[model samples]
Target chain A: MKKIIAGAAYVVGDAIDTDQIIPAEHLVYSLSDAEERRYYGRYALSGVPQGQQGLPYGDRPFTAPNAFRSEYAIVVGGSNFGCGSSREHAPFALQEAGCAAVVAESYARIFYRNAVDGGFIVPFESIERLLERVRTGDLLEIDTSLGKLSNRTTGEEFLLKPLGDVADILKAGNVFEFARQAGFMPA
Target chain B: MTITEKILARRAGRDRVAPGDNIWVDVDILMTHDVCGPPTIDIFRREFGADAAPWDKEKLVIIPDHYIFTKNHHANRNVELLRAFAAEHDLPYYYDPGTPNYKGVCHMALAEEGFNLPGSLLIGTDSHTCTSGAFGMFSTGVGNTDAALIMGTGKIWLKVPETMRFVFEGSLPPYLMAKDLILQVIGDIGTDGGTYRALEFDGEAVYDLPVHERMTLTNMAIEAGGKNGIIPPDEKTFEYVRERTDRAFEPVYGDPGARCHSVRRYRVEEIEPLVAKPHSPDNRATVSEVAGTRLDRAYVGSCTGGKLEDFVAAANILRGQEVAIDTYIVPATTWIGEQLHSTRVEGDTLYEIFERSGCKLGQASCAACLGGPSDTFGRTHGSEVVISTTNRNFPGRMGSKQASVYLASPYTVAASALSGRITDPREALV
Candidate 1:
């Protein structure tokens, strides 16, 4: 049985980019396996203290640290999630940081395709329930195959159904492998 | 056939195509970058089981464009990993060459190096990859995984897009450049008007414009939700390719009888300085609407805005006046930077004029426009509004989430930097 080991959950506001997930200045480290925590820090509201109010930083629902600190199989976010360049680094960085999935209200088209192709799970979860059950650092178990998300804190279970072709890609371990099974290539 | 129709036909297995055809065609050329390549490579190798890689190494071009100029050690190491992978895979065009390192920016480097052949279909991992369409190729941006799959298979599928033709008939006004012209087009079409379509530019205006100017027109085609924007090959096209490449020239043109779904024309003299306000590129307003607005930073860099003509235009405007307090200008590519640095115009390079006017130059690599590590607006305590010469100005694109970014041409950005407020270059140009 394939299982999702939920870990720390780091919540973020809308409109995150690959550069903020990992700055362009960090492009030099493409080959290395080093980990980047708070890679999206520069673009975060709390990250830039002084200019916090001018942009839509304060009203964003995901700024609370305790909500994002948890280790989980799923990371939930607001609408228009990952809306910018087709940079694949955004989803890759999140998955590498121990996030098995990113459940958001919406996703940029390119980012959506890149995520599924990389074997990372990006599902659109209930923004309301996701905001309520998970806080930073609380472990939650998500079984996409089973479509269940359990909040360990309150013993609450949330239903999740993978939409579109994302579920198929995740099940096959990535797009290329799926292609191979589909006879896209000669063995 | 025109260069565009020829290229599309080669992929579509048809001599010609009309608008509104739902057809899947094969990608002609594919590209990737280091950031997304490693993972895609990992997936590719796993799926293929490593006995043999999927695609021809020569056809795959991978370079590190995002963090080529980095202060971070980790990011630098990542680049090294990619370099090693390129070598291991025997990828021919593996590195970027220039003063800060490579010739300048990747797209410009590719253009100058002649990797972009006319009538070829090009794809890359960055959205700005469409910049190459200036060379009269069908180029667009995709995800790393998509690129990796193409790397392994040597082919990918794409839905043939309907092409919308824009005909420009007259010469541009003294102050307006290609950037202004694109803004005018976008404003007319509105965002989402061309969603999932191709924009084919024609008429005397497009043919008369320079190569770099053509690039500016096509680069923003993505902003209009276009798959690829193209200009048919002509005498100018042949000249550009002959100068940069050794490949035997093959002239491609769209048939005069080639069917176009929609056609529209504009007089170049009718356009004005335009700006795409925050949140969307389609949210356009004339420069007159936003002029005199104070700015914290006036950036003139990015694939769309960074070019020799752009640099010359900005330098001409700021030649006598000093940049207002807190204004910064960054050239998009290192080659452009060096060109500006070593270039001698009136006893000085454009860099000299920019530096003398209280402005400091940032390196190439999409700096400032995409928000580099050191470049930020609003100081540490207060928020700032930036008027950039780049293509996009969506929220949080420049630096802070709170900062307001207004997109314009190099002329407008430079004029604003001089006057300490957004102003059209037409008013200040003599």
Candidate 2:
């Protein structure tokens, strides 16, 4: 069963790309499966983490020691989330690291589709509302049925009329499940 | 109906489609590369369970351009797996590093080899695969899993995007090129303005452009949220395909009454050298706005920037001049690198000219574009800005996340590299 975690928000600045999600140096490793995600932090930042002995790409911003960790499943971000490179491993890396949904002001069309098809619910929301929720680390619940984002911590809720069938796909799990439920067969 | 309308129509089971009608048409050519191939194939294998033979293998083309020479054992493992799949399927066109038949990059090679023809729908597990629209084909990128499913079924569904007609008039300026034109369009439309829209390049300016230059325009259309940027077939396109491909057919053109939901016009004579400043491809401005910003690097390579004309253009400017202290010149493909060596003027090849200018000509690959394959800008804390010819100046696109990338045309990039700052190529031209 898919867990729809609501509440707790972390704010990421604009244009988050695959390099931040998973560094090219670490791309040499097996990316087929999801594993220990704490290591993902070492990659997201520009400098190396203390414990990791040998990482070429410097310590990333999205690390554990820095602010914004797995405490929040909802990530509110600036425009163009997952903008560069059509690396699906990026979504896999982000999801494995405990982000359930990403609320962005806007998303690169390819990244937006990649996230939805990869099973992460990336809903487009107003930048002001997202910033407000992230500033407080507020609790927000997404009622998929009604397509609304309710910030329990601030008592502020807004309707996020979901992107084309994204709500239905989210309810059915990943694209594979959505395709199955939609009665699509491999021709 | 023409080939495009017929193919899309037959797939939709309709005679023709007017603009704005969302029809899920069958995909014609499906392509994939190494990075996405492994995961996508994993899904296909799991779904098929040893009986996975479903799609026609001939239509599938797999090319591994990124990490062509794997850095280590782990990277090598992924290469092996992608190779194994190609071998297992007996895929006719598989490009491993060892294959002499390999072309430089998939998008460039696809057009060069003639897989991308007028009126075909090409889907790839690559965002830049839309670069094939230079041939007047409709191409778009898909995720790895979608690629896998398409590989299995030999088809995937697509919404026929509403076509936007960009009618261009007037001749291109001497220093101006298609890259500048695209930056101008991106400036007007912004990034998301053309979301899910097909851009049809029309008018005299597009007609005047050489095939390669036309490619430069279509390739960056994706940067502006475009599905495909197209140019109706012309004599130049027919000549290019005739010379490049063995199997020939008559050219196809957009119908006289071709339905376009939105039609816009651009006068090329009035357009200037344009740049998309740091952060987004759509954050565009004229070269005048951001000129003279000191640049640490000036790149002239990518599916968008690297071409024979780009090399010829840059070499013409720097033939008798010295490269700026910090400038670097990297070709986008090995084939082009060899071609540059063979291009001679006044008893000197272009490579010699570049080397004499104190510019370093590096190997072909996506250098300094996506970070970490070469001398990425901001090698130290102080190195701050770069003027590059590659597309997408998003943060960390050049090197360090803190550094800024300024996008420009090949002429602008080369001129800037010689000037040690961003200078209009027209101003610097001899």
Residues A1-187, candidate 2: write the lDDT tens digits.
Answer: 2334585665666555555556544544444454423344334323212222111222223445543245556766666566556666666656655667777777766777777766754555553536534442567777655667777877877776455546565566666666666556532
Model 1 fnat? 0.42
Model 2 lDDT per residue over B237-277, tens place: 87888788775454456667766667778888899888889
Backbone clash numbers for all candidates listed: 45, 11
Judged by DockQ cut-offs, the docking class of candidate 2 is: acceptable
Instruction: Give model 2's TM-score versus the native structure.
Output: 0.89
Q: How accurate locally is residue B204 in candidate 1, as Cα lDDT from 0 to 100? A: 83
Quickly count the clashes in candidate 2: 11
User: How does candidate 1 score on lDDT?
Assistant: 0.66
Query: In model 2 chain B, which range of ten residues has the least summed lDDT?
Result: B373-382
Range of the 10 consecutive residues with the lowest summed lDDT in candidate 1 chain A: A45-54
- Evaluating just chain A, the predictions reach TM-scores of 0.70, 0.71
What TM-score would candidate 1 get against the native?
Answer: 0.79
RMSD over all Cα atoms, model 2: 4.5
Regions of model 1 farther than 4 Å from truth: A1-83, A91-109, A119-173, A181-187, B1-6, B12-28, B49-54, B96-101, B249-251, B255-261, B341-347, B374-382
Q: What's the DockQ for every one of the candidates?
A: 0.27, 0.30
For residues B178-261, could you state the per-residue lDDT of candidate 1 as single tens digits? 888888887787554555567888778787888878888888887766667888777777787788888653445676766665
